[model samples]
Target: MSGEGDTPQAIRKLSPGRLVIASHNAGKVREIAELLGPYGIEPVSAGELDLPEPEETGTTFVANAELKALQAADLSGLPALADDSGLCVDALGGDPGIFSARWAGDAKDFDLAMRLVEDRLNEEPDMPRAAHFVCALALAWPDGHVEWFEGRVDGTLVWPPRGGNGFGYDAMFLPIGGEQTFGEMDAAAKHAISHRADAFRQLVAAVL
Candidate 1:
């Protein structure tokens, strides 16, 4: 027999019912809700439930995601799902990976954050503009059970950002082999190939 943390227990399947989306960001909540649309799971955001935003003290996306999910599950007394995502710039050694949102400041001013990223890249004039988006999703039950899934999408950083369709660093990120940045793509288009979508695919396969 193995310890609870290390035991290879069967993956828990989510029953169709109310689920808490453990996040306050409207963009993230909307995206997640859309992805969960076909699953028959009723999704409610943490903001809607007046849940406090948990301080993300974890160093990695996985840690932060699990932290949020568990907190929501414990507070709401329902199964909860959380996502922790960030942009990792190759030239900057994956800087802002877990602190992506913090760079936007308290106002959630991503324009300032995007400018900062561009300015940093300017300092390294010769370095490649390669970057990637990472998303970690954690699903937790009130009883302390959890499952994790992660995804990544590689791309390059563009200058002047692009469209206003998506949020965060979406405007500056051009997916590999794609001309339009994520900010330029419509929700459905972006959803088809985003890091979040990638993670959702894995979750769907395992537990949805």
Candidate 2:
């Protein structure tokens, strides 16, 4: 983690010439682009530029986000942004927090991963089914100056999964105040209240 974005300045303070989104995931890149759209910034993806997706060796979301941001910034000579996100369950003791992406592995077979989650949690069917989605966003310049923000959305787990709209564990997690699971919600609706959107608000206030 860069530990540099402790407090947002409450105003826009950034205007870069070009920015690199340091992620290869189409879903993540699209979400980020939508977030940055109002700011008059059209960012480019690391994949489009042939930048490498570095190994996520950090222990926490912020650390991994910072690593990706710094790597892209270094390689591309442009300010870079990265997001590390996951689904965490209380009963699972946050077992998949940092290893969320890893659990999906290179091929990203989240269907198999979600099945594993149900198998593990169903073993204790009487236990609490509380869970949440967490996101950490990192913004880094080529000089290594870094800013990071983390956000989360608490919710509960459901059985048999409900929808096929979202990737990862979206089908099984239901937010605290919402009836629809993330998978069941419409894309624009989900974007407005997602964990990633929460962190992006801080990113906007701190360094848009």
Candidate 3:
């Protein structure tokens, strides 16, 4: 298992240039753009290039992120970055990790997903509601040189949800040491202490 500062021995440094974000998700693209803003590199989305969303065949978040990045890099002949993130509830035995998107159904209805989570948990009220968000970032070059990092933030689920500032499961998750749910926090505040931010910090250290 890898932890912070534990760089993958196979990973190498990458020079900043035109990079493609391998995702159709608008929010993800925006968040990544913000993260890379300081580096002053041109960030383009796969959607912008009309790239197809590849099947997420990988079973784990890291593998899925790498798969997407490498696919986009190969298609665009440029450096590509990808992120696979999810909410893992301990009570659910880390479920909805890779299938987080699927939980939203084909309609991408996260409201239904959240309701499902609540309904399922209602069946087992004795179980803990502890959960965490996991994010895996993969950076791949056209030639297939890859660097990846994983980050996670611990928190607990709050019933009835709170706030409307974030998407997906943010409204129901209250991070450890935080007074409000992620959905209640503003962008700057959320970015300052998010799982993606942690993964970005690791990737920057490993291969910026």
Top TM-score: which candidate number?
A: 1
lDDT of 3 by residue, 1-208 (tens): 2322455643566677799999998888998999898886799999999999999998889889988999999999999999999999888878788888899999888888888887877886577889999999988888877788898999999889899887788999999999999999998898889999999988787777
What is candidate 1's lDDT per residue for 15-132, written digit by digit as tens?
Answer: 9999999999999999999999999999999999999999999888988999999999999999999999999999999988999999999999999999998889888558789999
What is the lDDT for 180 in model 3? 92
Ranking by lDDT: 1, 3, 2
Clashing pairs in 2: none
Give lDDT per model, in order: 0.91, 0.84, 0.87
Deviation in Å, model 2, residue 63 alpha carbon? 0.4
Best by lDDT: 1
In model 1, the runs with Cα more than 4 Å from the true position are 1-10
Residue 166 lDDT, candidate 3, scale 0-100: 73
